[model samples]
Target: MRYLPLEEITEDMCLARPIFNGDGRVLLSNGVKLSKNYVSRLKEMGYQNLYVYRVGEEISDFSTPISDQTMREAIHGVKDAFGKAAQRQQLNIRDVNEIVSYILDEILTNPNVLYNLMDIKNHDNYYYHHSVNVCIISTLIAKEMGLAREKVKDLTTGALLHDLGMVCVDPRILSQPRKLTEDEMATVREHTNYGFQLLRSERNLSILVAHTAYQHHERMDGSGYPKGLVGEDIHLFGRIVAVADSYETMTSGRVYRKAMWSHEAIRQLRESAPEKYDPDVVAAMERSIAFYPVGSVVVLNTHEEAVVVDVNAKKITIQFSSGPRVNALMDLEPDSEIKIEERLS
Candidate 1:
């Protein structure tokens, strides 16, 4: 099913997925037909559309964002904890360790949870969710980079708070749809410095993490903002967060464009601007993400339909229950047997 904007809402639109209140009461279950009330409640809650199957290919004129209820709850819990931490007027070392440990535990036990969050782009909860996504990606990248456990936890906290400066920026700039002019983007760039300042303001905050806010956007070629530190000059926490943040932002749906299908996003990253991003970090991210997520449907080269089963670092894994498998890899033999037609955007 595709998502449809509220402006085009109609009774014919069947609920392709579950619709529920923030409290978890089901307003409509999967397969339930849409009605005026269902649409109204969605609008009331600030949602602009519903996911529905159209004539043939799934389509959504409305920006139907992927939702992970568990992630939302986790972010809320983290937000509240931080609120408490702020009111207490100090970040206790033990408490900070506990928070990082919990985040690491979640990542270690449920890796897919992190990948799923990478797909969601809730405008209402960007900061908390982006923090969670960054932590997951940074920790994974750190592990791949061979950092030790203690170092991993420290870097993870830094990744989680990398965007903490956005809290100080004008909300209008953050949410603007049209591309920012140079002047606005310059202010946007200050998020790194602002984030550094915010964390520095807290006497008890972790200085390493605070620095991540400053250095996360720095590039190896010294093209990044706030500081143009290159290569070894940049902090490890900053470097890790840079890769994670870009991947998360690219995959998340935006008001201006439908989210790039995972495969396409990965392709772009792999090609790289060279000299800008570290080649090693790019490799790590490619291995860790599923460009074509499982449960997503795509057209196959065989001129038939299929659901994506898995996404590997080198090539997407598909299960062709109905036909022969295609050679999606080898350049000597690019799959004539089957090809993914397109992602259900």
Candidate 2:
């Protein structure tokens, strides 16, 4: 399956993966042939890219660190938990814990998998999807850093609910397409305190979990919000979530900005490391994320355009787009002189 920008998707290209709505219902099922109308509609809905089967190529499901069902359940659990909290009802800590546990198990099972944040997102439920993405990425970073299993669980739980305080903010303010006023920005920053109070009140949750919500915004150089804490003042869990949260936020489409490419996001993180982010945590994140995700179209130093088929392969697999080697598969050796120049999409 090739991941292509919506603008490049033409009629009759079959979808290789299902697209889900905010409620987790399938908007378009796998193997559905795309038409011009379907493509237009999807673009209108803010979908940036899609997974489609390359001509005459049939394959089994594309592998992910966690299954689609698990992602849907996690989104549902986060949405439901936020809803309950918004209504002043008890948050479903057990449901959230179960979702995190399942995610942790999947990551542990595939310890060597480099996570690709390529899931199609629905704009209406950005928070739910963002929460899950941060949790998954945080878990991967934790595992890569060799944190203990129990600590990983705590980090996962904290990362999953890091934005729980946003439930208290007005939805309109959160979705505003324009720059937030200084007053409006203050209200949004208060979410950390709001979330911390809410999580701390839960008898079953750890204090560290509550701190994750409070400190994910705090930076290493004492420039972050809610608190200007420098390095070490931020808890380990908080520092870890901060990296995951920032990376996910930057790479995710938001009301005010478009999503960034993974490589671009990584570059920004590296540029700001040990200042706005913990250098160690950022390094762990780099080890866990796929800079060149599968299904991406990239340009090689040899001036050949190829589509990445598998990043996890011992030698990465690339299919040349055209020329004498058109449609030919080549293994990109780790130390080869030929290198990827840039990604086209």
lDDT per residue as tens, model 2, 235-332: 98999999988888887765467778888999999899988898999998988888888788899998989887766524567788856897788878
Best by lDDT: 2
Model 1 weakest 10-residue run by lDDT? 57-66
Clashes of 1: 4
lDDT of 1 by residue, 73-134 (tens): 44554465345433544444455556667766655554333252223234555566667677
What is model 2's C-alpha RMSD? 1.8
Tell me how candidate 2 scores on lDDT.
0.84
